[model samples]
Target: MILLIDSGNSRLKVGWLTATEDAATQTTANGQTAGPLMRREPAAVAFDNLNPHALGDWLGTLPQTPRLALGVNVAGPERAQGIHDALARHGCPVRWITSREQLLYLKNRYTEPTQLGADRLVALLGVRSRLPSAHPPYVLASFGTATTIDTVGPDDSFIGGLILPGPVLMRSSLARGTAHLPLANGQVTEFPTDTHQAIASGIAAAQAGAVLRQWLAACRYYGQAATLFVAGGSWPEVEQEMQRLLKQTGGSPNTHPTAYYLDRPVLDGLALIAAQPDPLSF
Candidate 1:
């Protein structure tokens, strides 16, 4: 068993991968079984509040102790230390993943590639690994504490992206920065009459606008439609608005870029990286 962790800004996601042999891939010449065979397992996952105590307890609940642990941390070095210590207690040290100039066919186009977040890089790799046959122009939107909308170009390169305040932050900042807004808890309506609805509607619009702009820009740059993958906590609040926006927008030569919501893509990506025989090689 292998353990994979993604320590994000707000939470920590853990996945347990139990590798098994594939019956189809195990056969060799002369109807003899191969020396070794392994197939990918659908990982079982769990989460914690990013606290050392909570995370440690969760690790203790795993079905069996993992032999190796691999993870990516963007929650700061302190949290990284906590994760390291917890895994170390279980006798399975973690190998932290970082950004790279390149990873096999995927190239980092960031001016300073190392500055890119490991979560984003790993998430992109996860998407690419899932869509092995598809080529170019993919948009990934993560709406957590902060919203990140990134694009993968035709050449399989990270073409940079936009980072903006998430819906929660936008509303909280409004309430925090000013005195009048009472931390809007209103639902989004077509025409908001009250302040609460107005704040909620505006925040929804902002998130949708950011996602749409990036998706459309990628479409125009690549001269084709781009598939959009959205993940994170605030997705439920923004999905409807984005779907409305896409309907209002034209597709023309290409069909509408399908928007699919993914749960914990960062974890998915990390699991894929950890499964690699030489993950650090990338």
Candidate 2:
């Protein structure tokens, strides 16, 4: 078993993959098809925080110690060190996954590929590897400590992407940076009459708008059916808003992006990478 961890800015997603010699015959639980090396990922994964105990407890509960623990961290070096020590205590060797210039037949187009976040690259890999050939290009929006909207080509190219403050950050910033915005707790209504609803609706609109704009850009870039994939903690906050926003512009079935929710995509990506031969560097 290979343990996969997606270490975010303030949270961690954990999963386990049981790989066999006959990887060629396995398919992911999502039913998304991939190459012969592709295999099934854990049906459920543990979502935790930066606390050492949660991680230690989860490790203790594992049926067996993992031979290797692979992770991608956007939480900086200090936390990485802490995580390293925590896992080291459990006898699991740790390997960190970083962005490489090239991997899995996909070309990274960042001005410097190494600067790209490993979580983003890996999530894209998860989506790309399993995406059916029948679907067109797609946009992946990861909502976490920071939200990232990435556009990928049908030909396996990492075109480009944008980043913004995540939903919770948006509300928290308002409370911290402003005098009267009290960490809003409200719903996303079309016309928010109160401050609470206004703040809530505004955040949702910003997130959904950015996602839709990127989805539209992908459509323009590829001139084909483009799907919208929303992943991460804050996705539920804006999922409905995004659907409603899409309805306003998507007059026909083919005119707008069809949305799909991905569960712990970074872990899925790690599962795929775990099965494939190690790249020269990661």
Q: Runs in model 2 with CA error above 4 Å?
A: 20-44, 133-135, 253-256, 279-281
Task: Write one digit per residue (lDDT tens) for candidate 2, span 249-280.
Answer: 76786565446667677887887777766621
lDDT of 2: 0.77
Query: What's the number of clashes in each of the models?
Result: 0, 0
Please give the distance, in angstroms, between residue 205's alpha carbon in candidate 2 and its true position after superposition: 0.7
In order, candidate lDDTs are 0.76, 0.77
Sliding window of 10 residues with minimal summed lDDT for model 2? 21-30
Residue 190 accuracy (lDDT) in model 1: 71
Residue pairs in collision within model 2:
none
Q: State TM-scores per candidate.
A: 0.87, 0.87
RMSD of each: 7.9, 4.2
* Tens digit per residue, CA lDDT, model 1, 141-243: 9988899999998678889999899988999999999978889978887789999999998898899999999998998999987877788878878877787
**Roughly what TM-score does model 1 have, to 2 decimal places?**
0.87
